[model samples]
Target: MSVLLSACGDDGGKGNATNTPTTNNNNTTDDETSSGGSEGNTSTGGPGGTTTNPTSTTTPGDPTETTEGESTTDGSFITPPDGGGGAKECDQWTQDCPEGQKCMPYSGDGDNAWESLKCTPVMENAGQVGDPCTVEGSGVSGIDNCDKGNMCWDVTEGVGTCVALCVGSPDAPDCAQPMTSCLISNDGVLTLCLPSCDPLLQDCPGNNLCIPNPQNPDAFLCVLDASGEEGQEFDACEYINACDKGFTCANPEIAAECDPMAIGCCIAFCDMTEAGVCTGQNAECLAWYEMGQAPPGFENVGVCGIPQ
Candidate 1:
């Protein structure tokens, strides 16, 4: 019998424990297009091979796929609002921060991570989704060139690509891209529509990592790397996207190199069809899911772990 390891639990902002698997999060009515091969920011990751909105061009402990709908990070997880970033000012869905100002998610305490919501003046000629953007303060500062309904994402240095935010009620947030799923963060202050991906291909645009969705681990999505603080191999990991580009969080027991006391730790993913792909001693590429149980197009997905 296979031993049940602790779920890669405990976060830079980790994925949820739910294991709902699907080719698409919702039964997408449209046949979502297969992800593009360029792995470049120019291609739209939309459903039925359609580009809802085309954007401008654009990881890892060392990053390859780019951003997703509200999706961002390694391993996967959510960050609760600490209730410290800023006082509630306006509604993000309504874009009601006031004329000339827009509501955005940002770090009120000056911490590197986004912690709350605030109203900031919209830039003149703010960039739109699929456009190049710049951040005013920090990447999480929430001040950017993107207009309301969109935000700067996959930011490197102070420049990044603009991606759409989630619309509809928070309880049923939606994205224009049929293949993307909404991910909520900063205690629901920030909402994104991240692109879903095949874990085996890791085909996110421009350095985004592909891992199991925090919203649905059985499904994969493209996300940023550690919010700019990538985790190294064997580093204690909580968030699915916090790990370096080539690394993934594993149950500590499977990662022999991890500190014994850690909850989960960073490890590399390997191809099941290849041997000697794993970097750790006694580690091997073990099937990520039971034989024949993997989602279509991901039959070869594997993780570096000790044989049970």
Candidate 2:
């Protein structure tokens, strides 16, 4: 015999009651990539084993794998042979460069590494002095260099800025400038320069996601969910808890479930539309306690049985 108590009842007092999670509520801001890694202004992946559109890189988060349509975070690219690394031409693939020119591997040899690589050169207006680069290889923090025609320029300037290249520089008008709105390939890496830290900054490349800041809308904190992979769903109780005090997530769905730990956990609501109070959807229901429900013998509720 088990008894079930619903948290919806008087159990929710004024003071001690847990606050609902606060969702990001800031208006969309301009796009901005982080400086390095996921925190940096870019999302990365390893070789996918196949050829991809050079001009376009990856949509933030989604990486490439061995199969087409598959993604990986290995940071590998599938570039043509003559471009360097031969068949693995895309070893250093970036959004910069002409359509077919992207996916070229790093060519310059020296301690200069990513900064001196010919495939993607340090732009004239990097904003930051000296070379802006991370690791110089495919396994760790570096990216692949596309063909000579294309170049994924660094807009952020720092070591880990979102790099976007222009195909046939003379042809594309936006590519000529340092900071400008440009088209990113649906299947390649995407980067942007956001004005603020709003969650909208996560949408720069279009495929990445952002976690809301309970403290302030101005702070768009970066989440490391699936930077170089597909979007994955997680259990509600797994992470998010209630949002900060004083503020509650307007959407009960998110507040009810979002885990405090996991990156992407949404709230689930009970579907009172029918009979049983256990009708919540998504992962939010994991922590729900129905109201106005009575237990039979500390075993089960009058109507709503134990949550499945």
Candidate 3:
């Protein structure tokens, strides 16, 4: 009997729950993908792989100045509509702001005004390539967050910088600026900009490596190579790479009678062809492809598991 294993996939966004595994023969659809950092501004896969509407490119005004009935970081004066109650402040969700400002909604965390909308200054320059950005936070970094046509990639440790969105052909990629490489995510859903690098020679700057694109295997992107000790089986892990190379962060259902974690646990990789590769007495080596639709390059991958 063959066992199936379910794992997480990278969606260029915050990690979602692990997909449940199913039993079937060849052509089984495994919805599992790899896990990574927080979500980006891009849309999920649609019919014909079409992306949703891109972020707005409208520039915000000087973040320093404060407008009447608008919220700001600086200490300023602005009485509510009529001393206390007249016209409500702007509604970011409804885009209800004064003519000169944009509705910058509150993120509800870390010093942000929860459930409140503020009329922020509309600057002429926003969403430029290489500008610093944050997915969820007050714009205190001086750099305007993603405005339009740009997204904050690799959102980890509570920060994700800006990167221009790449559209069009995968073979003939067109990034916002020249010299930027169009890199695809592991789940083959998103394509964003990264500095070009040579994988064969491993000449990427710092600790980054040129890894093959999961969607388009022919293309490569500069990423951090797996290093350090591998996480042991059943250890808590944040993302796929958080576990040592050759191991995967998998759903706890893979283990017989084991409780699942909100994040996931590190599972040892196994070869289905060989018998008893999984060290767990109750665990079996299950082909990832047999469970569901494995990512493009993960069809042959297997994980230690117990039949679900």
Best by TM-score: 1
lDDT of 2 by residue, 1-308 (tens): 00000001111211111222211111111011111111111111001100111111221121111101111221211110111111222322243444433333231232111111223443333322112333233312224232232332221121233333433321231333342333221122222122122221233333222332211111223222221221122232111111111111112223333344432222222222334344334222222223322122211211111222
Candidate 3 per-residue C-alpha lDDT over 35-54 given as tens digits, one digit per residue, 9 for 90 to 100? 11111122111011111111
lDDT comparing candidate 1 with the true structure: 0.47
Ranking by lDDT: 1, 3, 2
Per-residue lDDT value at 233 in model 2? 29
Candidate 1 Cα errors over 4 Å, as ranges:
1-86, 99-101, 227-235, 273-284, 290-293
Candidate 2 TM-score, true structure as reference: 0.24
Model 1 C-alpha lDDT per residue in residues 217-265, reported as the tens digit of each score: 3456676444234357777654445456665645556656776665346
Model 2 RMSD, rounded to 1 decimal? 19.1
What TM-scores do the predictions have?
A: 0.63, 0.24, 0.37
Q: Model 1 misses residue 92 by how many Å?
A: 2.2
Ranking by TM-score: 1, 3, 2
Clashes of 3: 21
Q: How many Å off is the CA of 66 in candidate 3?
A: 29
